[model samples]
Target: MDCMFKKIAKQGGDIQFDDVETIIGPSVKLEGEFQSKGNVMVSGVLIGKLETSENVRIETNAQIEGDITAREAIIAGNVHGNIIIAQHLSLLSSAKITGDITAGSIAIQQGAQMNGKCSMVATVEPKPADVKQNAASVMQDTTELL
Candidate 1:
């Protein structure tokens, strides 16, 4: 295993490339939507949306020019679109990201560069009904005081 894999293991996660169902080789260039239910690894250039139910790995020298949605991701290349990771995201030192990110958890190395918004998926937003109930309760209490 490489240092990146070791780091992931230390963080209590495992990504096995041996089981990867899709691989975009370094010399290949793709220009359309790519969807997969299993793991996907990219070592080339992709210019469209990437959606995967399993993990996605972007290796060094790779570049992606569209949005990505995955259960987890490890990025060591360049990405120019939004990234949504349902579980976790790891940005290695070589990563250069230029769009928003939404992830349940994220880990960025010291040299990783990012230039957009980041939202945590673990945050809980109150439902509209709940907010309305709380507001009404507050109004009732104020009226009682009056």
Candidate 2:
């Protein structure tokens, strides 16, 4: 908490977190799944899944190449995977993302570059086909007719 300790693998650092804020140092590389119950800030290279019960922030110059799921996310980096945010998603000016995204709300900055599908909704419902098949069975009244 004093000097902001950096991750060991990188000379600079990979990720940083505190009671309220989290920072991912520049250019550091991480090769594994990451899960957090609090907010997270990424400013390095991550090659795995990222999940957070709280908000996730990806700063400029960061690169994440895996699935990300969170309550909210702010991306200013480069991501090459699917993202599912339960609450909100923000793409800042320097962000470059190439993956599908689903969130309750979304914002993309002027200079951001995203090449993927995006969906906005409070909750994700099952596909219509999946639901329709079940409906057909429910209408079967063989027992009642007998």
Candidate 3:
């Protein structure tokens, strides 16, 4: 597991043939919650939640029916559930996603399909005071215009 994560961390952001801690083959079907401490690669069908501490890769023939939570992900398959990624996410040309996505950053290749909204998350949140100040300034500007 440690070796797999080291490979994931050392590699560039592109999803390549990195070391995998878990691999689900094309003939297998998995149900129930799947958790991993390292990288996961799936080429099969999954019907439950997937949570990974590192990266996740879904191959072109894969199909997933539940939510996915990962630090980073690359999808080249069919997914019918929401995805939450803490870092980078890439949807390849063959990917089809049917649910909303939340990620720190995302890249969608040509021919990729998505039916739901995508929201980008920031690594650092603004301070409450900063938000309040911005809102107050905006309100003041509007009032002056009125």
Predicted structure with the largest TM-score when compared to the true one: 1
The C-alpha lDDT values of all candidates are 0.87, 0.76, 0.85
Model 1, 4-113: lDDT tens per residue? 33334416666555577888989999999999999888999999999998889999899999999988899999999999888888999999999989888898999999
TM-score of each: 0.78, 0.70, 0.75
Off by over 4 Å in 3: 1-17, 124-146
Better of 1 and 3 by TM-score: 1
lDDT of 2 at 143: 50
Maximum-lDDT candidate: 1
Model 2 steric clash pairs: none
lDDT by residue for model 2 (110-139), tens: 999989898999885545797988777666
For candidate 1, what is the TM-score?
0.78
lDDT of 3 by residue, 20-118 (tens): 889988999999999989889889999999998888988889999999998889888999999988888889899999998988888888999999999
At residue 134, candidate 1 shows an lDDT of 99
For candidate 1, list the clashing residue pairs, or say none. Answer: none
- Number of clashing pairs per prediction, in order: 0, 0, 0
